[model samples]
Target: MHSIHNRLFLLFLSCMMALLIIGSYLYYRSTTEIIHDKIGDMAEKNISQTAGLFDLLLEGYDSVTKSLNSNYELLRLLELRDKETNPAASANMERSITNILGAAFYSREDIIGIHVVTHKGKLYNYEKRFAGVIDPGFTDTDWFKKLKDSSGEMVWMGLYDGSVINTMQKEAVFVFGRQLYDLDTYKKIGVVFIETDPKPIWAAMSNVTISPNSRVYIANNENRIIATTEKDGVETPSFSGLPRPDSDHVIVDKSTDQLIVAAKAELADWTVFGLTPKADINAQVVEARKYLLIVVLLLVVMSTALATLISRNIASPLKLLIRQMRQVEMGNFTGTVNVNSFEEINSLVSSFNRMVHRMDELIERITLASISEKNAELQALQSQVNPHFLYNTLDMIYWMLDERENDRLGRVILALSHMFRYSSDWQEASRTTLRQELDQMRHYLTIIENRLEGRVRTEIRIDDAWLDVMLPKMTIQPIIENAVKSGLEPLNRPGLLQVYTRTTQRELCIVIEDNGIGMDERTLTELQTALSDGSSAIRGNEGHVSAANGGTAGDRAVMKRRGIGLPNVHRRIVLMFGEQYGLRIESKEGAGTTVTIAMPLPSKGRKIDEHTDR
Candidate 1:
C-alpha cells in the first residue's frame, strides 16, 4: 500500500523512536532503582576474583608444562639423549638435576624430595637440604615402568602420593611427572616430576570478596574440582559454579541452585564459578541504576544514531531492492533492483540478475547432460571395484581347488555367484536380517582371504539373538572396506578383523573391530568432512546423497566426488531408521579402530521390506 521509499523512511523513523523510548525507559528505571549497583558489584567480584583463580588454574596447567620441560632438562643431563637409552648416572645429565627436582616439587610445597632410577637400578636424588644420603632405590614403581615403556615425547602422570618425594617426617605434596627424550636420537632421558601443593589454587580464591560470605568453587576442564573451602567436602561431583541457561549466570553447573552461581572461563579451558547469595546479586543491582543512567543516556543516543545510519545505509537499499525482490517472490527473473546509491547493492542486483539467467540455462543443460556422463563414469568405477573383488574370489577358489582336489566346486561357485548377483542387483539399503548382511561380508572376505593367503583373519560373531534382527541392506560393506583399505593395509603385519552385533537397552549396536594399523588425525578429519558433506541441501529429504569419498559438497559440483562406502552406508542407515542411529568411528595410532553402527531395534508389529527407489 505504501511506496518503497515512504515505507523505508517510516520504518527508519519507527526504529529510531523505539530506540529512544526504550533507551530512556531502561535508563530511567535502572537509575531510579539501585538494582544495577548490585550486578556491578557482583560482576566486579566475579571478574577480579575469578580472574585470579583463573590465573591460578593456568599456573597449574603451566606447572604441568614446566614439569614436562624438566624432563627435557633431565635428558640433556643424562646424555641418555635418545628415548631408548637407559637413564644411568651421567655428569652431563646431573646439571639439570636441580630443575628436575624443582619442577618435581614446584607446586608441591609438601614434597621435600624425589628419586629416580636408571635401567640398571642405580638411584638418583639429593636426599635432603639438611640431611644426607637417603636411599633413592626407587625400584618397582609404576612411574618407572611407564616412563620406560611410553613412546610419547612427553608423558603426564596422574595424581600420586608425595611419599616418594618426601620420606622426611615433614614435607608432603602430590606429584605428577612426565618422561623426556633426547631431541635427536630419540633415546630416553630420565623422568622429571613436579609436586603440586593444591593450596595455591585455593589461595587465589581466598580473597575474592563477595558479600563477606560467598565462596568460589573451581573446576578444571574435566569437571574435577581439586580443592574447595567448603567443610562439607567435595566428596562427590557436587561442586557448583558451572554453566546454566536459566540465569545467564549459574552458581554451580549441572546441579541444584541452593547457591547462586556466576560462572565464567579462565585463560585456560578451566571453568571459574563463584557462588554468592542471590540476595547479594539482586541487592547490588538495586543500587546500580542511579549511577548507570548517565551511561545509559549516552548509550541510547549512540544506539539511535547507529540505528538510523544502519537503516539508511543497509535497510534502505534492501527495502528498495525488495521491489525487485518482490518480482522474484512473484517468480520473475528478468527483473533488477534500482541502482540508487550503494555500490555493492547495485552490483549485487546485477549479479543476482546474471545468476538467475545463468541458473536457468545451467538447469536445462545439466538435466540433459548429467545422466549419460555420470552413469558412464559410475559404471566404469563400479566395475573396477567388482572386478578386483571377483579376481580375488576366483584366485581363492583356485587355491581351494588345488588344496582339496576332490572339492565340490559347485558350493564355492554358488557362494561367489550369489555375492556378485547381489552386488549387481544394487537393490540394497532396504530391510534385511543381520544374518544376510553378514553372509555378504563373509563372501567378500573370502575373496580378501584368497588374496592375503590366510594372512588376514576374520572372526564373525553372529550372536544367536542377532540372527533374525534386520538391518539396512549392504550397510556393513563400506565399513568393512574402510577398515580393510585404510586400517589394515598399513600394518604390513597380519591382523584380525572381528564383526559383532548386539542389542542392549533397546538399541541395536553392530561393531566391527580390526587390529590393523589405524589412521592418523589428518585422515580422521578427512573422513569427518567426507561424511558430513555426503548429503547436500535439496528441495526435500528425498534427494540423493552423493558418496564422493574425501570430497566436500559445494557450488563447485564440477569435481565433486564422495566415497561410496562409508558415506553411502551411513546415509542409508540414517535415512532408513532415524538420525539417532548412525555410524561411529574410533581409532588410535597403531591401536587399530572400531566402527559401530547403531539403530533402533525393530518394533514387534513392524516388518522390514526393501525401500524401493521412487
Candidate 2:
C-alpha cells in the first residue's frame, strides 16, 4: 500500500549508510597496511646499502695489508737477526722499512696508523713520530692475542681508545689486523695492524634512522651492541626486543608500538637495526579519518532525496513492462506492454515487442533447418554404395580369363561377387558387427592384391574378441580403398598396407597404415578441411554426390571424386554414437599415411539385434 517514493527513500538511505561504514573501514585498513609495507621496504633497502659501504671500507684496508705481504723488503727486515753485530746494515734496513710503511699510510686517508709487532719483542710503528721498537709489551695485549688466533685471516677489533698508542689523536678508532707470514719459509713472522677512522661507518648507520627519537645500532653475532648512532639510547631504549638473525627483514611489536627492520652486514657477521615508532608513521592517517567521516554523512543525505524522485517516475511503467515479460517467458509472444511514463521507458517497451516477434520466427526456422539437414545426411550415406566397384572388379576378372583362365582368376571373381552382394544389401540395417565388416574388407583386398600382382602387400591383425563390436556398415573398407588409390598406386616400389585393431577397456580403435607415397602437409590439410565440410556440402546439393562418387579418371582423380566416402563414414559414426567417436587421418609426404577409427566399446549387456535406432 506504500507509495514507491516512500519505500525507495528508506531503502536507499539504509544502503548508503551501510556502504559508507563498510567502505570507510576497508579504506582505513588497506591504506594502513600499504603504508607499513612501504616503510619497512625503505628501511631494509637503506640498511643494506649502509652495510655494503662498510664492506667496501673494510675491503680497501685489507687490500693494503695484502700488498705488504708481497713486499720482499718488509719480509727481509722481519727475518733480520744479529742487529748488534751489524749495526750499520740494521740502521739502513730500519730506514727502508719505515719508508715502505709511509707509502701504504699515504695511499688511503682513513688509515690512522700502521704498526708491525715482531715475535722477538721488536715493534715498527708508522705514525707522527715513526717510533721504532716502541712497545715491547704489545704482544701481551688482548688485541694481539686475538689477531694471532685468527689463523692468518683479517679480524675486526671493536672501538678502542687511541691514546695508548699515540697521544696526539685521542679520539676512539676502529682496529683490524692480520698475521703476516714469510713468503718462502711459510712461517709466521709478525702481525700487521691497520687502524681506520670510525666516523665514516657511523655516518652511514645514522642515515637509516627515520626520526630523532628513533635509534639505529649495529650488533655482532653474540648480540653485543658494537656501534650506535645514539650512545645513551643503546643502553636505555624504551624497547629492547631483537629479532632472530634468520627472521624476516622487518617485524612489528604491537605491545611496544615499534617497527624493527634489520639487515646483515657482509664483512663482520654484524646486523644493522632500525627501530621506529608506529604512532609517528600513522599520524597522517588519523587526521584523514576525521575528514572522511564528514563527507560520508553529506553523501547519505543527498542520495536519499535523489532516489525518491527517480523511483516515482520509473515505477509505474516498469511494473506494466514486467507483466508483459512474464507472459513472454511463458511462451505467449503476442502480448505487448502499453505505457507512456517516460521517453526511455516507451522506447524499451517498443523494442521488447519487436524482439518477441523475431524470436518466434527464428525458433521455427532453426527447427525446420535441423530436420532437413539430418534427412539429407541420411540420404547421402545410402547413396555411397556405388555400383562402379563391381564393374571394375568384373573387368579385371575378364582380362585374366581371356589370358590364362587360371584358378586365381576364379578366386578373385568369387571374392568380388561376395563384396558386391554384401555392400548392395542395405535393407537389413545401417549398422553391422566388426566381423562382417572385416570379412567385407578382405574381399576388397583380395581383388586389389590379384590386380596389382606382388606390387602391393597387406597385413590384417584383428583380434577375434573384437569381432562382434557394432559399427557403421562398410566403414573401414572405404578408408582402405582410399589408401590403395591415393597412397599405393602412385608409388614405383612395392607398397605395404597394414590393417590392425587395438582394444582398450573403454574404446576400440581400427588403424589403417600404408607405406605408399603419402600426401604432403598442404595436400593433407586441404583434404581434411574438405572432409570436415563435406558432410554439409553433400547434403546441400545432389551434384556434390556425383562429383564425389562418379567419374572416369586416374587414381587421384577417382579419389577426389569419391572423397564423399570418408566424410560419409565420419558423419554416420558421429550421428549413431557421438561427436567424440569419429575418423582421424595422419599423413606425411615421403613416410606414409595412417587413418584411425575411434569408437567406444559396446556395453557387455547390450545385444547386437536388427534394431535401426542406436
The estimated TM-scores of all candidates read 0.31, 0.43
- Which candidate's lDDT is highest? 2
Tens digits of per-residue lDDT for model 1, 1-614: 25544555567666766876787677666664444455445555564565566555555655654554545556455554223353454443554665565555544444445555444444455434535434355445765566667564333343333444445524444344555555677655555544445455556666553565556655555676534454454333353334532212334321343234444443443445555555665454555654456666676667656655765676677676677667767767666566665778778867777877765555544443343224323532464456557756766775777577734453455456566655555333345677888888887786567666667788887667667766656677656755665556445688789888777775778888887666566655655565565432221111111111121233224323333456556655655554566777776667787778887765466653322210
For model 2, residues 1-614, the per-residue Cα lDDT tens digits are 37565676677767877887799889878877787777667777777677777778778877889888778888788778324448788888778787899999889887778888776656677865443234446566777788877777877776666623555556778788888888888788888887777888788888777666567877777666667776553554432357644422433333457767677666676777877778766765666666776777677667776676667668777777788889988988777788877898889988987888877665554454344334433443454555457646666785777577677877788787677666766657667888999898898889999999988898999988778878877688777877776678667999999989886786678998888777666656655675565444432221221111211234433433323356667666765555576777787766778888988875567664322223
Per candidate, the number of residue pairs that clash is 49, 1
Candidate 1: C-alpha lDDT: 0.55
Assess candidate 2 and give its TM-score to the true structure.
0.43
Per-model CA lDDT versus the true structure: 0.55, 0.69
Candidate 1 — which residues are off by over 4 angstroms?
Answer: 1-381, 384-415, 427-431, 535-563, 604-614
